[model samples]
Target: MSAGTQRMRAAVWYGAKDVRIAEMDIPAAGRGEVLIEVAFSGICGSDLHEYADGPHAIPVAEPHPASGARAPLVLGHEFCGTVVELGPSVTGLTRGDRVAVEPNYRCGRCPRCRAGEYNICRHFGFAGLMGNGGMAEYAAVPAYMAHRLPENVSLEQAALFEPASVALHALRRAGTTPGTVMVVGLGPVGLLTVRLAAEREVPRIVAVDVSPARLHRASALGATDLIDARLGEGVGERIRELTGGEGVDVAFEVVGSESTLRTCLDATRRGGRVVLVGLAQEMSLDSFALVNNEQSIIASVGYRDTYPELIRLVAERGLDLTPLVTSTIALDTLVPDGFEALLDGPGDQIKILVDLAARSDRLGSPEASAGTRRVRPQPGGGEPETSE
Candidate 1:
């Protein structure tokens, strides 16, 4: 690592099943950009999909149809960091302030951004997905994307703002404000949705999951009712009975399975709103039945301008995600161990954080691991070193 050039390390996604930790020089914050020393980075479901499959968020091999980012991208978006450096001419920000990053780098000049709907920006891309992300020691992000973290929140907790915003956006899309709510899928986002929905003044949250362990977590988080999908074939029947046949007013689908999508739609009341926040291969629905029932189905995409509200709400007492946090590891464990844990046993696990400064015996110094170095085709002939 050069003294003048701080080479930061990050989990580089080369391709499907080919993720390696690579070192890149600490990037200079361009105009309107701020450099952050990442404190913690959380993993999301989409990240898992990218790990197991291809066509990752913010396309790499091909320019993202939307974000315009190409392959060999750094993989991380759910993270929180502190501003250590600011770009020239940037204002209203400073050093040493804790903050959460809203990863989507939308072309601010686009029609959607002009209309304040940047999530659907004609050109949208998230930090870790679209550009270099917080999986590294230092990340250069847009100044507008950073939100100040409250004093009471820990770095790990603030990292959740990304996923929490995803759920909040889903709820906001469903008009899920201050009322009865149903969250199907007990993963990180589902649990965060419950916690945030409570802060929104929703009196009851009924959670459904296939894992009993998740149901227990939901109960601890104030879920009034828990349904174990593994033991029952009639989940819709159970939900209807639990709600006294009125059915839930709003349902959030966080499980990325076709069946869960159908279940979410079925669990909502005739006139209720259902927010489809999950990403799955396919879902079959009868158009006539959906229209005739007057059911409002909303497909909430990535968060727009909602990180500040999430930070504020999370700092409040109503939504405390501290308990939902499951574990914390260093960045070196991200590709090898962290990804394994997330895939093998994410049941009941709400959030996992990668701490930047907390180096363990497990994570070696940046240059010590030859195992993480990459070998690539040299020019037009042999392979070459791709890392420090």
Candidate 2:
């Protein structure tokens, strides 16, 4: 590498439970792409899935068609950063601009992309998992995948745009109307659903979760009723009770479990819609109520084009996402303080951000101008796990 060129550090995923911090040349912005210096990268459920039970969304043996890259992937999808460079033919963005990444890369010729439902494009691929990602000090991404962040949205909170947009898309998929709504499971997506639903002025919003800390956060985010899933059999009853026995107008199942799906069905009135936002492989359901009661089951994936509006919501509508981030760590400490802490489970952590510039920022050093640097995993940090 030339002395003028800088080497970047990244959290590279070799396989499930195997992520390493290695040094690499800073990526160059390709045609119709931009090079981003990542500010904050969030450890998403999908990242956790890769760490816990992965090679699921991430490509392993072969390269993905859309991303055209395979294993030893740089793993991170939800993140925000500054545009450090722009490539040929790219427009509407300049260097030094702050932005959040949508991360969804689609084949434009696909049916879904042509129909404006690109989230479900036949060749759908994610940047972080399928290709180069923001876990590193820098990443070069297609311009379409980048959305400018508003001035009011902090770089830290900008990391939340992707997840919050997922919640917004779930609401859109559910065709959420102004009425009673219940969001089951207070994970990041569920909590954001509650917050967005409140912003949309849903008359009654209910949040359900087993975590008291999450429930408290939900209440603070504007959920009118809180149901503890620990209450077991009585959970659905309490939801129905809060809705005056007729049940909710719309029920969102953010926890994609058999019981949570059942709770969604039982808590919605006849002919109401039930939206499934959580990532669950298989779920069992009662056919009688599903068919007889005429409940509509809607499944939501990542997101469509919800970023611009979400940015506007944050900038103009007073949407507060500050509470979502419970912890922040440096890139070198991602495994111990970021991923492992989240994996240790049932803790008070809602969202953890890996500040790519944390160490460099503190030292007043130009991260990209620095030469190659490598950071190996800690003793217990690299042991592979068998779950997702």
Candidate 3:
């Protein structure tokens, strides 16, 4: 390695509230890898859990069993970038291809991975959680992890595929398609679910949220009806009222709080499906209700093979993420002081984009490269693309 390949800048977390925006090595792409110039990275709610609380059930600094990345590590899983170089054994990918990464880097040899349930492999680990994800200027990922975007997708829109895939994965788990579904909690995941349901032509979407800001955001994102859980009124009753007193075909528990969980149970119809996707504070379900309702409860993990479709839904059909993205900041804002703002900022913000193009002049964005892609104005509560 040359001295020129010494280091680059990254925001690393040593421990709780100990993340430092310091310089680290700009990694070289090894065999079967590709070095990507990260264009945009979204700060996840999961990252907040690690920042505000303890080590997110993942202990202090160590190399991820999957990616072999050790701590103090860079923290960001949701990001989009372009392939600048490919390592030996990497094929069919080259420079300047805009792509979104699948953050789950599991050992393909594991039982679950071999069986096509790679999300739960024995060596299962996430990009930001277990290893160095896309927070840095450049990330060397497996060549296979790169899913190229269509000519229509922007880098910032592509960055959203990571979380959007999660929602799609959950909706698939719940078998929710073209039906009246109830999504509890209008955070990033919940809001995405509402939009996905809308795009999929789901008839009625009842969005439930404690925050009035989130309720308004949900309504803006294609929710047919909104219920303010903080109104201190019975949320389940409102959900039932919205659903014609029959409850919904499927219920998505996006908020893992105790009260939200209860509302999830109360809002679903008999023999309905309940998809538990969010991490819970406390998980205890009543045995009596479980037997009586006979609800098919499904717990979905990250995702499996949904990136291409997720991107297509946004790029081709023009999914609306603008309402979700309440703020956008440059790369310098992602460091020292920006970290706090990312954590403690407004609840109305569904998504916050880190513009890598503004920071790295040499490494340009996917949008800036060709100028062929175009985003049109959205319809009622639909998406509108970014422009100069």
Best-to-worst order by TM-score is 2, 1, 3
Candidates arranged by lDDT, highest first: 2, 1, 3
Where model 2 places Cα greater than 4 Å from the true spot, the runs are 1-5, 360-388
Tens-place lDDT per residue, model 3, 229-327, is: 775448888788777888888889998766677788888888888889888756777769977988777899889989878777777777756567766
Q: For candidate 2, what is the TM-score?
A: 0.91
- Scored by lDDT, model 2 comes in at 0.84
Write the number of the candidate with greater TM-score, choosing between 1 and 3. Answer: 1
User: TM-scores across all candidates?
Assistant: 0.90, 0.91, 0.87
- List the pairs of residues colliding in candidate 2: 52-387, 53-387, 53-388
* Candidate 3's TM-score: 0.87
lDDT of each: 0.76, 0.84, 0.76
Residue pairs clashing in model 1 are 60-70, 60-71
Residue-wise C-alpha lDDT for candidate 1, range 115-139, written one tens digit per residue: 9998988877777776778887888
lDDT tens digits, residue span 229-290, model 2: 99887888888888789899888888879899988888899989999887788888889878
